[model samples]
Target: MSAILESADIDRALKRISHEIIERNHGLESVVLLGIPTRGAFLATRLAQILKSLGNEVPVGTLDITMHRDDLRLRPPRPLLSTLLPPGGIEGKHVVLVDDVLFSGRTIRAALDALGELGRPKTVQLAVLVDRGHRELPIRADYVGKNLPTSSNESVKVSLLEVDGHDSVEITGAR
Candidate 1:
């Protein structure tokens, strides 16, 4: 495996992304962040910290898409994580879906389905740490930390400090 992003690099990318999000929205007003469970939640918290530093107090939530995935029957049933939203919920708010990596776009699709059931947001944006192209769906991330053109055989792994005890991204060769 080859290390593609170190801790500092990931931080820098997230900082940049936070700024972009703030800039695009013209401010943090009426904005909410929902992270796809696991690493995405970590990233959302990190981004929230950066946004706080920027003087924008935005709400962050966790979205668990386990039941919304297309291949649900392909695997055995497992425990589902909690899907927590802010106090007011996503009603007419600008919701930003955050994730560690964007690969097949299936996860984001599942997230979209999951989001729809919660509440109808004014707009839904996607933010990903890495955008490794090989899209099975037409989904795309609005803000990408690093656009690493990787082969379909290779796998990109993102390790976050919140869960993995470290923040780094590595590319592992095909099995």
Candidate 2:
């Protein structure tokens, strides 16, 4: 595997993304962060910590789209994870869906479907650590940490300390 982002690079990208979210939203008063399970949840928690440092207490939650995925029948079904939300729910609040990487956009679509059942948010936006463009769907992220041009055969791997025991990102396959 070839390294694409180092720990420091990941930290910087997240810092920038956090600032952009606050700037675009004008503040974090109505912002709610929901991380797509696995690495996304770790990133969301990191973002929440950064926002907290800025005196804004952001609510971070996890959203598992395993069941909402359209390819459920194509592959073996895995155990479903829990979908946790803040106490107040997302109604009338701006929700940001966080993920480690944006590949085909299918995951984001599944996430949207999952979110719909929870509650209606005033608006829903997407944030990803890496945007290796190869979108099969029309969806796009509102906030992207890094827009890395890539190919269809390549794969992007994100490693987080909370889940992966380290913080880094790598691209594998033909370059």
Candidate 3:
């Protein structure tokens, strides 16, 4: 496996993404960040902390899209994660869906369905740590840390300090 992003690299990318988000939204007013479960949740929390330090306290929450996935029938039973929304809910707020990686785009699709059931938001955007670029759906990320062009045979692994005890992004598989 080859390491593409080290700890410092990950940190820098996230910070840049945070700044872009602030610039695009004209500040974090009425902005709500909902992280897709697993690594996405941790990334969202970190982003919230970064945004808070930057002077705006944005609400961060987790969105479990296990039930709304399109390939549910293909996989075995999976445990459902908790769907936590910040106070005031998602109604009329700009919801940003954060995830670790954006490959197939199905996860984001499921997230949209899950979000629809919760409440109507002013707008919905997507943010991903890595975009490997093998989109099965038309979805795309609004905020991306890094765009790593990858082949279908290769795999990108993102290790975050929150879960993996370190930070790094590695790519493995036949080149």
Candidate 4:
């Protein structure tokens, strides 16, 4: 495996993304973060903390899209995660979906469907740590930490300090 981002690099990238988010939204007002369970949820928490430090408190929540996934029958059954929303919920607020990696875009599509069942947001955005091309759907991230072009055979792995006890992004597999 080859390390594409170290701990410090990940920190810097998150910080930059935070700043961009604030700037793009003209402030964190009415902004909510919904992280896809697993690494995405952790990243959303970290982002909320960063935004808090910047003087704006953004609500962070976890969105489980397991049931909404299109490839459920193609793979083995998986445990379901929690879908927790903020205090005010996503109604009339700008919702940003957070995830560790942006690959085929199927996950994001499922996330959108899941979000629709909850409440109607004024807008929906995507934020990903790594965008490794190969998009099967027409979806894109509004805020990206890194755009690491990679082959389909290669896999991108993201380890967060909260879950993996370390922070780094690695790419592995046949080149």
Model 1 C-alpha lDDT per residue in residues 58-160, reported as the tens digit of each score: 9999999998989989889968986899897999999999999999999999999999998899999999999999999999899999999999999999998
Q: Candidate 2 on 1-175: residue-level lDDT in tens?
A: 8888999998889889899999989988789999988889889999999888888899999999998999989988789886899887899999999999999999999999999998899999999999999899999999998999988888888888887898889988875
- Model 2: residues with Cα > 4 Å off, grouped in runs: none
- Least accurate 10 contiguous residues by lDDT in model 1: 74-83
For model 1 the local lDDT of residue 58 reads: 93
User: Candidate 1's C-alpha lDDT?
Assistant: 0.93
Q: Give lDDT tens digits, candidate 4, residues 110-137.
A: 9999999999999999999999999999
Tell me the spans in candidate 3 whose CA falls farther than 4 Å from its real position.
Answer: none
Predicted structure 3: clash tally: 0
lDDT value for candidate 2?
A: 0.91
> Deviation in angstroms for 7 in model 3?
0.6
Per-residue lDDT of candidate 3, residues 54-81 (tens digit)? 9989999999999999988999989999
Output candidate 3 Cα RMSD: 1.0
| Candidate number with the higher lDDT (2 or 3) | 3
